[model samples]
Target chain A: MSRAYNFSAGPAALPESVLRQVQEEMLEWQGERASVMEVSHRGKAFVECAAAAERDLRELMAIPDDYHVLFLQGGATTLAALLPMNLAGADATADYVLTGHWGEKALDNARPLLRTNIAASGKAGGYVDIPPVGEWQLTPGAAFVHYTPNETIHGIEFRDIPDVGDVPLVADVSSNFMSAPIDVSRFGVLYGGAQKNLGPSGLAIAIVRKDLLGRHGRALPPIFELQNQAKNDSMFNTPPTFAWYVLGLVLKWAREQGGTAAIGERNRRKAELLYSAIDGSGGYYRNAVAPAARSWMNVPFFLPDAALDKPFLQEAEAAGLLGLKGHRAVGGMRASIYNAMPEAGVQALVDFMADFARRHG
Target chain B: MSRAYNFSAGPAALPESVLRQVQEEMLEWQGERASVMEVSHRGKAFVECAAAAERDLRELMAIPDDYHVLFLQGGATTLAALLPMNLAGADATADYVLTGHWGEKALDNARPLLRTNIAASGKAGGYVDIPPVGEWQLTPGAAFVHYTPNETIHGIEFRDIPDVGDVPLVADVSSNFMSAPIDVSRFGVLYGGAQKNLGPSGLAIAIVRKDLLGRHGRALPPIFELQNQAKNDSMFNTPPTFAWYVLGLVLKWAREQGGTAAIGERNRRKAELLYSAIDGSGGYYRNAVAPAARSWMNVPFFLPDAALDKPFLQEAEAAGLLGLKGHRAVGGMRASIYNAMPEAGVQALVDFMADFARRHG
Candidate 1:
């Protein structure tokens, strides 16, 4: 089969180019004696690889010198808890803003480690809009303020980074990491599993402020200790060497494609193309999220009649657009246009959507 | 580099045939519309993929029906903490039998969550021999007994699986898992990172007794909770999809190669051949581990003079026997003979050792 546009929320589509390179290098990587996966992370070859990947990421994100870029495992779900465990000490509380399902889940995940204060919540506000920064009544002694930049499930995104006002800010950028350039200095920590904009799942990249690590009063599980990981240069244990290797290759691919800036623009265009299709479909297609809070990564839309959703997705799949099924929470359709998704794929999706609306409306 | 033999411990070599199959399916797995990595673990496609892998593994090892096999992330290091979190909650002091580096590390990792009793330690025994089980000062009311079956660094291995008496026994089989047939019912939990014996790094597989799950008294990290993971069928969150997919492929390959019994016998022969070469070379080369305790996986040996180590490693690498350099803690040569190191590879290593000894003796 020819190339199909995969819009999986995560563990998602990578660049076909990356996959080809990986496939080619499956036996041997760039004259190396063994496949990159076969090498030790501590080996000189892998040391160079890990360092170069970090360098590329730093350059791509324009990460500040104070920030320590860590390649972690366990994905964002684990990070949801680890963030609190690392940043919030024993008996400490953190302020969390819930914009959608992701933020709520993050808070739920962190509940055991920290006394969490819901400083701002979108549930009461209909989960479509972000609470204004000036309106947040954050706890006076909050250890940090945590929020998700993009909610993949709810299709809500904060257009601007929230001003936490001296509070260390932590963002789970899983669904949208590296899609655009961001002011790294604004946050204490930003981490994302690589499946979406980076490489594959299993490799979680954490850009943490060096000083913010190791502050948790209680002992952390070795893998949860950011300081330990940083001190060992992310080799505290046998790391997922092969995943990191693929991520390094993805970093190289990202660099070759003019980095995150260009990729971000392309991603924005893809989302815009798809969103426009929904808007222009004459009430046939509907988006639940407010326009200002709509995500550029995952665009979840609904058809006027729910019965047509499956057929729409099936037909879209036939036309080379896959994973357009919406999350179970909001069962309609979601077109997650991550970094690897080409603008042409979005155009195809849009064209298919319009034809479907005409056929079913 | 004519299919060089790699001996790097953990993240070691995989079968050339398996690698080729992986290469063939890297872009498109089986007849699935997308690569295995792109398919959701929750989907029927991956459900079958994971099931088949488990089935193959069980068949190969003669695993009993009472065990629940879980594919997890974060490697064995994650299990170092999680084992206690999952098992030591209801019971207090857990007994750990430390054989070498990994055993010590695993026990140290488990220390924070529970009271770890060093029931038997080989550290005082020079880390060359497994301590006699009769000498272990068993802790009364001990939750469970944990040990590393094969110590990768010190090249020490348990000659027999420790009979923990009535207490449950768990083994971190990272380096030796799936290389041989195992009595699944003999242990409470058998877990390991897949890099050593299966596919690539990032994914870990555990064969846990169905009864030993969800015993955590305090709320633990969801990812660390085996029950939560098992409940979700190891897909509670997006797993390391690519790693898990590759692991499935490796397990399939393992089954195809006449299963683990055959692989284990081959491994035994390989280990015997290499060890005999070192033993036969008289004082030219020597393995530090006692004869009975030498690992079938990692075999660490010393040159007659320490000064020749560098030249030895360099020449060996040049000769296409890569990663023979010993770990830093033990400065010498280490030949890790995992499942992937074919009989031919071991023979090659044996030939090289004998030839080198004759030239330098």
Candidate 2:
């Protein structure tokens, strides 16, 4: 059966190969009598799979040896609180550079838990561009500087990591993870929800510097303790084994597709092709994000006439391109071409976009 | 593929039909071109699935209309902290009846967060029996009385709920959820990890009375706030979509098998058959749990000598009765017969037990 080009921002598209593999392994995993979800987390098969997932993720990202890669639950939104809980002292200030909705949300969440300073904010500019790094008013003795590299809601992405001198950097890469290669050493901690560019929802991955652990200012739940989770290899509790297994399969597929570097190039091309379609639509289609800040993973665009938005989405769905509607906050259309979206899927979306523009423009 | 009779304590066996259905739907769910995992949580399909899962579960358990069903992450372990975070007021006392490892662990996690009183402890009896209700020393002004209905590690279960007047009753029913009929009205909150009788690990369900929402005394992460979760139908953040889908399928299957009442009867028979085999083994097999308190879900037992443990496990594995080895805390053997285990699987275990006894008795 043919599959639709699913463009969901998260709980998004996954590699067809990974889904097929999971289907085959549903009843029996490597001759084991149960599916990976049915097996024990401490069992050899799942343990090996979990290890390999972390190993491959490290290899792909070139994570340093001093970093602990933890497969956790609660997603990146949960990580907003956990990052401060695990990294910053109760009395210390944590600087937040708010690029879009997520960073602002993170700052709001961390406010009651710790002292926070808005290093910079792009909200005044309508979340259309990143605040210039040089203008950021960072706290001199801040615990860490947190940022969101990409905002899924408005399709804002930072092209480069901001230089924070000796201060540690933390990022929420939920929308752009594995879409490109990243410098793991530049950040003290990097985490993302495993829905885009990874596998499913509910599971999250946190890559933290080893020394940054065990320093939380207060007693936290064991699940929120990074050191405890890292020491136990993210099995501090029974993890989302199925999501973790699916992530391993996606990682395997990512490696086979020539790792992050190759995928990054493909993602760039997909973004360029779709953005070109939007730019050439002669005001028929418009994207609010600045040209330099356009996210390669999530492309949010608007139609000149809001009345036609419904038809565009209806026609797109009829043509087998799905989930192109923008987030409610953005209120337009978005095409999230994650790693799992082949160039053909982007081509399908672009083809539908052009056809819609011609019909409605 | 042939399946084994898996007896794992958690992340346990699911109905074979559910697994097969998941395999069939792995590539495409219904007419949607993506697997359920690949869809947006806010999408109609997933929203419907989540609603139906809660409905079926409510019907199976006879949940009252006033209770809100929340699909969450972090498992029961996370619930330990969340229970107090959401339920107990600042400085309010909460009583715990320590029947096994989990209850003690919960108390330990809650101690710094709130005032906790241990109403009773079964540790004095080696976790072999439940403390009598008359012996409980509950605090008069306690916000809640928490208990674990079944101790997975030691195969101990309370045959009846302890009467805690005025105070809310919370239970961690991870090991025995959906295995039998339960009076939903009797509980203030009933939470369980969805690995044993529900679906996979990582996802948890909490059925809380609606009035309990927004009573949290302390600031909490949005994800940890049950009121926020219930208000948003547990989509406060991206949930474990695949686990949630699989749980829907499991719930559907459970309904087809005559709901919880019939399943409970079947579970009882399976436990009876397995326990009888151990009891009639001519002093060769022994179970530490009191006969009245023995869990129909988890049956932990020992052999005549410790030396036979390895051989017994090896033989059981060879005979396709996998994961029969007991928890590390209670070293011997255990056969967890959740609702998913068919009568044939239990009969196979019973037949194997008799044959082994004949040869080694």
Candidate 3:
């Protein structure tokens, strides 16, 4: 089968051009007479390659100089565990605003190390909407405020950065990183796994405010210290070199696609196309997320009946659409259209959704 | 230039055949119409692929059924920290036998989390040889005995597994894993970064004796628990899919190359060929490690003078030999001949060495 529209939540679709370049360079990268994976991370070529990627990402995101961009392993979950360990004191309380599944996980991961306050929660509403900021019961003099900007599982997102009032805002941006322009200065830490909108699995990116590091006053294994990673340029140990290189290629591809502003517009258009289909489907299809809180990356929708999901997926795959199955936690159909997911792929999904509804309804 | 023999210590050379297979499958893997990296880890195809890799690895290493083989993120360094956190009680002391750079690093990583006792150390000898096991100060009730089977930077290797009575032996086999056959039952844990003798960076393999897990009364972030990883099949969060797949390909390639026994014999032969070249150089070339402790995987040899080092590396690259530059900690040259490095490449390096020595001498 030819390459289809892959909508996998993560370990998701990558741009075709990047894959081609990776294939072309698989045998010998940059005249080194070895594949990029086969080369040493500390070697001159790879160091420059890695540096260029950071530079490109900084330019693309307009990252502030005060922020340190780290390319790390262990995915965002590891960072979730590391965040409180790295950022807060042992007895400090941290505020959490839970809008969806990922937000709940962030709180769970942090609970072992610190006192956690539920600043706001949408779980009682089936995670269909973000809780109003005015209603949040934030802790005074808290260590930091943490939230998930885009929840991959429940398809809820916070469209604006919440005001935490002098507390650093930490975000798990795994599913929606680089999907739109984000203000780097607004958060103390913005971290995510690279598998979603950036590149592939195995690599995670963390953009941290420099001043926040080394303030935990807690003893940590050097490997788990975000400040140590920052100091070493994330090469305190052997980094995921192949993943880093591929991420570099993806960053270059993103720049070629006219940076984040242009890509953001394109993503907005894709999200609107699919969401409009769900909204216009009348009784045949329905998305549960509130209109304002719906994620532009992951849009979970349900068919009129549970019995139709299997056939709907089968027919969609037959039509060259793939990975539309929703997360098991929420048993319904989900179409994850990230930055790498072209507008045409979303269009094809919308078209399939309309066609399936007409026949099944 | 065509693919040269890459002698990088880690993030090192991969099997060309495996690289070819990865390249071929980059666009559409196993009829999924998506790169293997783009597929969901929970999906049937990828789950099966990940499981097959584990099966092949178990078969290749003859891992005991009582052990759990986990494919994890965060390099060996992360495992070094987690080792004590997961395996030892908070108050229990763990014994460490340090042979070289990596062993010291492992101890450093574990120090913050545990009571560490240096049972033996070769560092005083400038890491030129592994200390005699008979001389080791055994800890009567130590939680575990840890050692680096092969020290990559110093080119030192333990020729035999140390005899430590009932205490489980934990070995960081990062640089020499799968280079030869060994008894898996003898180990409590054998963990390594995948880049050297396995597949690529971004993935680490841990073969842990099942009983060793959950012994620690330490409260850990669930993500840091090896037991949790075992229960989840290393998918407590997303695993590094592409690295896992490529590792599977490498394992299959290893099997096709007549399994570990044959590969071990071939590795021995490769080691002999390069060591003989350096030994026969008649004072022009010198390897500092004792013959018994000299690594079969990494043969680090020095020129008679430091001045010749630059020209030697330049000429080696011109002659299509790459990554021969020795670690900065030990200046000179290193030729890392892992399982993927063909004996023919070693022969080419030997030939290059002879010609270069004859001219330079």
Candidate 4:
């Protein structure tokens, strides 16, 4: 009956503090004349909110001036299709580094709009490890090289950015966006659906190297045309007002946590604590992803005795932890501990997971 | 400083009750222990919310069993492109009835996606009147006939539905939805961007006839694919949660107001009060739109002496009636009284405008 520590991958858990602030301001934001949702996008209140959010995002990522931070709709899945439309002109081919489900899905979403070349993949290794950047067959004249920095489903990640020579390196950074420090200058474009590490599902934050914008040309639909949206300050159409409002609160929360670097350190410790619990569970708790490539956000593991999986999930739900069920493709359990999941929540999950392993192993 | 009456066309005011309810449930809904925005779309809580919203909408609209209601984002403008893509196959053209800015924009948005045949138009009349339905040149084999029922900009409305027979007649009821009773059987499709009469901007509600469900055969992307969206219950991707949630509250409010009939009568009285004030101002105020075709949702009028426009607007703002400025294309004053506008607000605007006419004009 008490507050359940939500473990849903996305739309994921948010800071209760941020939610409380939003609750206080839902009807009238800072004594403004309307609900945050009712204000015009061109109106000063929303304009200021959007600017502050991007500024906080830049400070958190240590984003360079050359990058254009955009708030868009459609989840990473939609961004999957949009990446090619915005980056690859007509017949241009792009390189895709397929580390896991999200990377492959991104390529699938883009393939209809443009040609795609697979550079490297860890699927051959059963998604247990990230394919090394050295093994990727870098296409010399690719429009851009795309990869998912963190794979949500299989819980894989690339610790280092891919070096693609002069090729633009674009990443789907959904699961790990605010969890850690990232070099913004290294990417031509970095974007993701906000449901995971950002705010909510309706908003996507794209940090693009300013020069890549508008090169897609105005011929694209106004919504997908990054140049048009960027020029108009992303008010080309009516945006998801409340979602953007919540994002402002989240950004404020991030700043209070001393930006992404501090949060990243906390996130690192949380991941290590949970992984250690599974590793020491003596065949009872086994993770599919390799140690070096395992994601700090999503930790997917299987009970050695598969039959106990049903009871494990049932008891976890009854005990107040929810959404720990694994993706159908890789059946087991997935505990997603994003930026909002305090270290204590991870410790709680690790302790319960270990105790379950001891009794049922 | 009380909450002023906001009359912006879209991103307009919401039901005060709904805003209060959202404020009350900001951190918890039914003790779910998560902000509605943070709940996973796939979770039982949100999926139930989405379903209940659709069910409530069906009850409000009296939408039949055969029609599917889709809650997607990208607004009516996106639907301009999506309609043609989903309904118009290769070598097909769609018919459009252009009354004002909305219809013209829809035509422009659909240009790249599919060819358009303007079956009727009133653009020559400065968008103040509707072209008679009888004089229309119907495209013989057009995919569908598109039109805007209530022109938000020019303050026009199609008083009667044009009989399009089997060629699905689609209406963008963005500014007009729920203001009056509508016969759902009269059209094959009905869609509205939520900003106006619904909830917020990012969510677009489409009521598509069952037969037209999945005809978008050629590799349609996931977000806009009607059939795919329906099959996945609009969770093909995460939806705009806050917008969707607020819309449910609005729908609930509508039902409590005795459904569309009672709301329609109240809207009629509000529109009449404003127009009577405009007509009785001793030629000080002039409404350009024809009497028979004038819209109840948006009442746009001009001052007798254009020079006093600035003073009039200032005084109106001082009177706590905000968003009275007209669209840039038409520089005058427009008061949009949606379902949320209490009768007292309209009375207040009328009283303020009348007093201003006596002093300025």
Best by DockQ: 3
Worst 10 residues of 4 chain B by lDDT: B216-225
Could you give candidate 3's per-residue lDDT for residues A1-361 as a string of tens digits? 6999999899999999999999999999998899999988888999999999999999999999999999999799999999899998779999999988888888888888999999999888888988889899999999999999999999988888988889999999999999899898999999999999888899999999999999999888899888888999899999999889989999999999999999999988998998889888885888998899989999999998899999999999999999999998898899999999999899999888889888988
Tens digits of per-residue lDDT for model 2, A298-354: 999999888998998899999999998889988999999999999999998888888
Categorize the docking of model 2: medium
| Per-model DockQ | 0.67, 0.77, 0.86, 0.60
Instruction: Report the lDDT of model 1 for residue B146.
Output: 88
Q: Candidate 2: list runs displaced more than 4 Å.
A: none
Runs off by more than 4 Å, candidate 4: A216-219
Per-model TM-score (chain A alone):
0.97, 0.98, 0.99, 0.97
Question: What is the DockQ ranking, best to worst?
Answer: 3, 2, 1, 4
- Residue pairs in candidate 4 whose N, alpha carbon or C atoms collide under 3 angstroms: none
Sorted on lDDT, highest at the top, how do the candidates line up?
Answer: 3, 2, 1, 4
Q: Candidate 2: DockQ?
A: 0.77
TM-score for predicted model 3 compared with the true structure: 0.99
Better of 3 and 4 by DockQ: 3
lDDT of candidate 1? 0.84
Task: Write one digit per residue (lDDT tens) for candidate 1, span B1-361.
Answer: 4568999987889878777877888777666556666656666777887778778877887888888888888888888887888885734889989888888888778888888888988887679888888999898768889889888899887767777787888899999898787787899999989988887888888889988877668787566678988888788888888777777778777777788888888988988898888888877888888899889999999998989998888888888999998888888989999987888888888888888887777
